[model samples]
Target: MSKRDYYEVLGVERGAEERTIKKAYKKLAMKYHPDRTQGDKGMEEKFKEAQEAHEILTDSRKRAAYDQYGHAGVDPNRGGGHGQGADFGDIFGDVFGDIFGGGRGRQSRARQGSDLRYNLEMSLEEAVRGKDVEIRVPTLVECDICHGSGAKKGSSPTTCPTCKGNGQVQMRQGFFAVQQTCPTCSGKGKIISDPCTPCRGQGRVEKTKTLSVKVPAGVDTGDRIRLTGEGEAGESGAPAGDLYVQVNIREHEIFARDGNNLYCEVPLGFATAALGGEIEVPTLDGKVKLKISQETQTGKMFRLRGKGVKSVRSGSIGDLMCKVVIETPVNLSTKQREMLEEFDASLGGGKHRPKEQGFFDGVKKFFDDLTK
Candidate 1:
């Protein structure tokens, strides 16, 4: 027979939080506990079912896989086992430990610090050539005085006397054996009577730190550089999280970048466009000479091989594309204007202005078709 959904078995929503799932499972465990049932096989099976649901729902990786693939994801026989098989003693320790703040699994389940992101803006020149940058970040760091232990120098934490360091106390409520966090210790299992002065027993302190980050070449906007263990200090001295330096390239006045290629518009004189000549175009490296053919049209694109940005992924160089826009002469002298008018009249047969002639011809045909 097929199994029931874990969420349904626990009487909780699929998106229920860990604490809520734990609470629901605790209630079921209390109701169907074998100690209370006294050899009733039916209650034992129900108790096992609740244990299974609690185990799957509480684990992040197992929960994620179960959420996507159902029971097949966590089933060890089917090979989608992201779950570490639940143990009876360990599960009870967690049930009472985490739910009641017992801190029984503190050694094995120390939480990591939160990841952080810092946005860094760069110039095109700086991006093309990788550089090291200095940045200051405000975050939590392990207390220098306490060394993340929350205890005073030359002092150590002592085990709690209330629950005998089990972090929890078992109470007999009629037939039910109820487990709860030790009130005196607040579930820490240990106590730091003389706390660190700097961090005040928190084990971490807020401060600003300076760090140097090396940016790789050819990284575009939205690329990130990750520095491992550079984020805020972890709780109870666990491993720190990573810091992501997000890249945002400042807009360049001359060039636009596209996937290892650099693009720019070069202004061409009208005479230079009409007659073949060598002209200088700007590139990332420097200016390079480009030979323009006669009758070069505006918006003409020219590719300069191996003149663009180097690929960050492939270690290959790209090309630079120059687009030519013909610039009409302004503030012309009387003689220059006269010469241009004379030159314009000489091409009256319309052989030199193919685009202008074709536009007028198309307009004429459109009007004729409309009249018909």
Candidate 2:
């Protein structure tokens, strides 16, 4: 007969959480444990069924394979047994008193630690030019005392009597038995008689670790720097996690950045706009000469090549674009006002201002056409 769906056998939905999956398996296993039934063949089959279901669903890797390919993905007969056989003792040792066999299985192995994120604030200058910074992060590290064993010196943990070191228990339901984590050793199989003073039986301690992070040049807001093996320590001496440094660049005083480009607005004197001349303009490297042409108007843009930022991902440099705004004379002296009035009188008053001359010409034509 084909095997039952693992989720259906455990009485859990496909999206059930880790804790929920464990609870459902525990309830079904208790209802079908062989020890609870006396010489009943039906109960024995149910108990075995629950055990098989628990074996596949509890493990993350096995569960993923089962989800994608069903029983064929995990069945040993189908040549999918790259993983060793799942031990009932490992699953139900804590609860069932090691009915299968009490011992630490190879299923529990050292794994990498979790990853962490730290938001780092930077000035626009630092982001453009790059900088090095130090950060302090609080995380769990392997305990120095007892060498992460959670035991007193010269004394090691012993196998849990209740689980017989199997760390799981068997629950018998109405017609089935299922295996689950034994509550005795909490699935560790070994019992710590004397807990470590530092970590308090966890084999790890919470401490702040100082780390130096190098921010690369041209990195902008929302960019990230990944620090490998800098996250929280894993359980049972597993591998560590990675730490991510998130970049948040502060607003600049005079410039706005868009990708690799830089933008700035510059104010020009009226005389300078009327007559072309060279003036010094500010750039990241230093000041550069920018020429304003005669009759230059407000909102005129000038592009300075290779003055903008280079992208972190792509090394392409960009241009710095400057928008010019003409400033009219303000708070003119009495003599200056009189001189301006004399100059205005000398204009011949009609066609000297080309813009004004064109406007009147168009106005005269409009009225003449309307009259016709």
Candidate 3:
């Protein structure tokens, strides 16, 4: 029986570009693949025809010949085969690799490894100032003994016999041909008759690798740093994956960070709040001097410029905000308690405390209005 035109089978014009032809074939292959249309003999036959059509159309030389003389131009018996076996591997790799997730497709087969994440715990000081840290990761590495070949010494992997090194086997149901991965070779298209003893025919081994990663200054919690090629090894000797170092800043004893700003509550003695004095404030680097103005109330804030964190991204420094909280004397001796009582008596019924005096005036007004 005479074969149908390759362009007609793929539903593309004869002048379609290689990319257009590939796109059309990929859609048809996905739609008519036996895995997708199981128990359907008619669709399976169309799938085979489509595959054969795509095989001829995608090749530059074969496409040229078929376009000029039709199927007779590339017939195997007419010496028009012109590397027909090579085309079968290309199609099998592209279609089934997607179905099984074993990494197929001519371009996608050599894909880089997957990215991995590592949560790193750090102190607030370390995150603000930045640090170089050494981390040990357990991952897969190429087997030294096998050199990533998965074969024993003095021997190499051979083409898979079950799939005839095409990595797929076609099943016939009546007039249909359905292609699937070869169970023997697992669709790798090659077989290791003599397996590597070290990697056990896998060509990779588990190893704990130590690496140094530099943490930039002012990296906050939830920030991530990408370390290139620091993840797991890829299959078939592909490139290694990336490693992401995630930052988790520990809670600070004295300060809380908000973006590049630092907030800290400075403990002030009652005397320091009452009488003007100088008090010491803590920063990430060292202690700084802060003035306590007379009659300074609790929750009063003071800004210390250029004394906060320097941002890693913006490179702009932020300010340190100091909030004053007056701490009452605790565990006082009898003499100290007597001194406080005398000081309280000197205030003369809250006359010297304007905030307390004004609060009582508002309270009296609120109740008088309620009564009216």
Candidate 4:
């Protein structure tokens, strides 16, 4: 029987690009793979046909010949045909590597070191003004004794006999050829006959390293600063990872921060709040005198512009918000109590306390309406 047109087998257009052809083949291969089909003869044949079609269509020279002369130009059984058996290893490597962890020879894979995170605590003033901090981190570093070779000073690593330096071994499972990391070499592709004393045959050693990190101004909690190449050391001379310094601002006794804004509660004496006066308020910089308006109520907010923090990224300054709480006189002496009684008798008509009068009036009206 004559073979089906490669494009027809893969369900692609005659002029489809290589990528389109590969995509179609991947779909069909996944659907009809022997493992999924469970030994169905028809599905097995269809899978083979898709693989063969993909193999020919992806090769530029083979595709051009097939496009000009159809199957007759590329059929392996035909005289002067250019087609050869499809390489299962290459096919599965492209499609199933991520799924099965099998693919291209991983011989001498250079793994990148793992990134590390360090929590750095800072005071509000330190975060606002910025400071240089020293941190000690326990991480992996390249072995100096063997120079990261994992071998003794006088000896060197040799190729593994099991994988023959390929770093991978091939296993045949039914119709599929799988490539896996070599068990003996553990994917390093080499063996250390004489191990290093310091690192114990590993190319990296654990050590504590002290580094100086420059903290930028106006950095809030949860902000991060990156220090490159300060993390764990990579294996087999690979590139080292990075260290991220995570900022954690400690709570201040007098102030709370939200983004760039600073909030604080200011206590005012009842006499000062009612009579109006200038009071000293604390700020990150220094003490600032704030004017308290006459008859100022509790919970009144006073805003001090540009007294908060400037954003590190935007460079825009914020304001400090102070909420005042009126404090009443406590532990009155006999004279103070007598003066307070006389003061109460002097204001018997509730003329100075408009809020208190309005509240009592509302309460009386509610009771009168209920009685009616």
RMSD to the true structure for each prediction, in A, is: 16.6, 18.0, 20.1, 21.3
TM-score of each: 0.66, 0.63, 0.66, 0.68
Q: Assess each prediction's global lDDT (C-alpha) against the native.
A: 0.76, 0.73, 0.75, 0.78
Global Cα lDDT for candidate 1: 0.76
Compose the digit string of candidate 4's lDDT tens values, residues 273-299. Answer: 989999999999999999999999999
Q: Determine which window of 10 residues in candidate 4 has minimal summed lDDT.
A: 91-100
- How many pairs of residues collide in each model? 0, 36, 0, 0
lDDT of 3 by residue, 1-372 (tens): 335668888888756788999999999999999999986999999999999999999888988766533453455543222231222222211211221222223332224444445557899999999999998765566778878777888898898888877778898989999987788876777888888877667666667689899999999987989888776566557776666777878788999999999999988998889897998889988998998899899999999999989999999999999999989899999999999999888889766888899999999999999999
Candidate 4: global Cα-lDDT?
A: 0.78
TM-score for predicted model 3 compared with the true structure: 0.66
lDDT of predicted model 2: 0.73
> Candidate 2, residues 1-372: lDDT per residue as tens digits?
345667888888766788998888788778878888876899889888888888888889988766543453455542221222222222211111111121233233233444555668888888998988999875567778877677777878888898788877788998999987777776777778877766666666667689999999999987979998777565556666667777877778889999999999999997798788988888898999998889788899999999999888889988999999888888999999999889889988676568889999999999999999
Q: Output the worst ten-in-a-row residue range by lDDT, candidate 1.
A: 91-100
lDDT of 1 by residue, 254-317 (tens): 9999998999999999989999799998887788899999999999999999999998889899
Q: Rank the candidates by lDDT, best first.
A: 4, 1, 3, 2
For candidate 3, list the clashing residue pairs, or say none.
none
Q: What lDDT score is found at residue 302 in candidate 3? A: 95
After aligning candidate 3 to the native by TM-score, how far in Å is the CA of 191 from where it should be? Answer: 1.6
